[model samples]
Target: MRRPIEFKLRRRTLLAASAASAVAVGFARRGVAQEATAAARPAGPETSTVTLTINGRERELTLDNRVTLLDALREHLHLTGTKKGCDHGQCGACTCTVNGERVNSCLSLAVMHDGDEVQTIEGIGSPDAMDPMQEAFVEYDGFQCGYCTPGQINSAKSVLEEINAGIPSHVTDDLTAEIAVTDAEIRERMSGNICRCGAYSNILAAITQVAEERS
Candidate 1:
């Protein structure tokens, strides 16, 4: 009877220790997660002035250090033409022209482009007077839901411009030779821009038409 009682006491002690260890581990994990969350959070309302050329005009703004170019355009500047699809660089829905080059606005900080030229769809054209690329999109049914239209147009325009500028893409045959505007080339160049509605065929047609007209 004495031996059994001793063993029971030991068992209870072991169980209690295991439970305490588990609790400590859980608390440690939670602490790590909290630290990560805090690290990811943008650090402030501290502001600075930024001047970006949107479309054709230069707009000045005072923005937070953490403010993304996408937020600056949509939330601050009141230019909502640039859609925030994934808000990550993956979707390319926030594609915009920066200094004659295309970039994912969501991936860029507003302060990074203090003196850079930024162009959104709104700056590209308006409802009454649309750019040729915008007109092509309309005529070719390049968009279905239209949520991704602005990004698609911006990316498409950049793809053409890049090709014209002799920039080689993954599909380009020769690095030294001028890049030709082909379906494969367009597809490869615009691969970063995702269209969930799958109007790919129409989009291709529109891009092709623009390439031909410009050539």
Candidate 2:
């Protein structure tokens, strides 16, 4: 009888130990599943659809709400001329004309301007028939790597228009009349666009030539 009692006690202890191990295994699996589910969850909001006129055509695209106008132009529309230097608004590589006004495409969102007209570098001129600014850039050797030329030309064009519209620059002494497009004014207005290759001399020459031609 003592042997039988000892045997039964050992069997019960073994069963208890097995059950505890099984429970531990189940908990471990549950923890792993929870971790996987958390990781698989999406980040930020889902994409949405937006339509806008680009260049001279209307385009529709479904993009993430967080997508910027620059990304939409370059990634979706395949207008890669708008360079992405400094995704923030600091660099003017993503400069484009929105409704006749120059704006940093990187700073704006595609959804913000639903129906606005966007003019990218591609829209400015074609390879065969170049815009005056494009021709001027080539004639004056305004670019080194040609990375910032698009933004530079776009900004310069807008600056000239602004000067014609009687807008004053930071260096303007009097805001009562149309500001003159002097070399200093050009430098001050085009300060946002940076050419890493130190092509300021050539760029200024190109812009000055264009301005003089237009004047």
Candidate 3:
């Protein structure tokens, strides 16, 4: 009355193979559907002209609407000082000023800043005419790799400007009092920037020096 072992083994093998085939077919169909859906998606917009006042100069470019301000500066304008780090606006490597406010250029679209005054590291100063912030960084050895220097300097400049303009930060003690260049203030302001080389002390010193000289 019992079935032969060989026959039972054969049946089991066939069932397993059938189940495997079904799974394979399902996966293949899912992959094809995904591909087709991707193919059906709309394409990015055509090129558009964007006018930017970069570093005090009028410049124009025809670029995709998705191009970020960082790319516009580093690629289109050939200003490579603004290092693209993290690319997600987490790292302050692409920090730059737009209309006198410090912004993460990597997160800002070039098209959105049309006719806006954009300032990058190049616009800040040259070796011969180094900006005070740049010089302070060098004098204090604020950077080791120097990849984040441009953004740090830009952000530092903005930090000082914000302090001078009485823009209170989270660490600012008195909202109604004039912002002072305190360690807490600087650290809070510079928290967005990350120096992988562990150059926080030096950067703080540089910013402090510049702030002291200006004050």
Candidate 4:
């Protein structure tokens, strides 16, 4: 049978529209598959095993290659005392002693320090017997809210060691020798540790008092 010219034209248009819809759906599904493939790819080279000496105990942890040392300590080991004020190493809240030198724990990665000694706030003292620095902080009221106290005490201990080792600060006249710990010296050296409680005056007093007693 011969169909009308208008009817034939309408049928052809419907077929073309159906084909176009099917093509669009196929592209959309392919895009979703590509996204899933990308997400399923394994993490790159930075992931590995790390062994650290924490609080006089040996511990092993497996972490992503990009995990920061601070995260390894806090998230992996459950040591929450080390606060993360600024993960960019700007704040010293995550400060810890590494081989007798204090460093911003967040600045380094866990995998970078294999067989390294790490000392966090919990490692330094205990609730039953507090370390001298902890006691000094408490007695002098060096902090309020106490978020930065751990880093402050750890940094303070290192500052005294640096002073005894003849390290110089910005206020030092000679760069080659250990600098004395005056009020200004303590202030300048301990500036890396910040307390939002406006406790600078008391913090300086605590550090100065402890330094003199040790001397």
Highest-TM-score candidate: 2
Q: Judged by lDDT against the true structure, how good is candidate 4?
A: 0.89
| Inter-residue clash pairs, candidate 2 | none
- TM-score of candidate 4 on Cα atoms, chains taken together: 0.80
TM-scores of the candidates are: 0.78, 0.84, 0.80, 0.80
lDDT of 2 by residue, 1-215 (tens): 69999999999999999999999999999999999999998787877788799998999888888899999999988899999999988879999999999999999988888888999999999889999989989998899998988999999899889888888888998888668888889999999999998889888888888889988
Q: List the lowest-lDDT window of 10 residues for candidate 4.
A: 172-181
lDDT of 1 at 101: 89
TM-score winner between candidates 2 and 3: 2
lDDT of each: 0.92, 0.91, 0.93, 0.89
Put down candidate 1 lDDT per residue, 1-215, tens digits, no spaces. Answer: 79999999999999999999999999999999999999999876898998888887889999888999999999998999899999989988999999988999999999999889988898888889999999999999999999889999999999998999898987899999888899999999999999999999999999999999998
Residue pairs in clash, model 1: none
- Candidate 2 TM-score, C-alpha based: 0.84
Whose lDDT is greatest here?
Answer: 3
Model 2 error, position 209 (Å)? 2.4
- Higher-lDDT candidate among 1 and 2? 1
Task: Give a tens-digit lDDT track for model 4, residues 1-215.
Answer: 45687788889998999999999999999999999999998757666888999988999998998899999999999999998998887779999998789999999988888999989999899988998888888889999998988899999999999989888888887777657788888888888888888888888888988888997
Regions of candidate 3 where Cα sits further than 4 Å from its true position: 1-44
| Model 3: lDDT to the true structure | 0.93
Worst ten in a row by lDDT for model 2:
42-51
Root-mean-square deviation (CA) per prediction: 9.4, 3.1, 8.9, 4.2
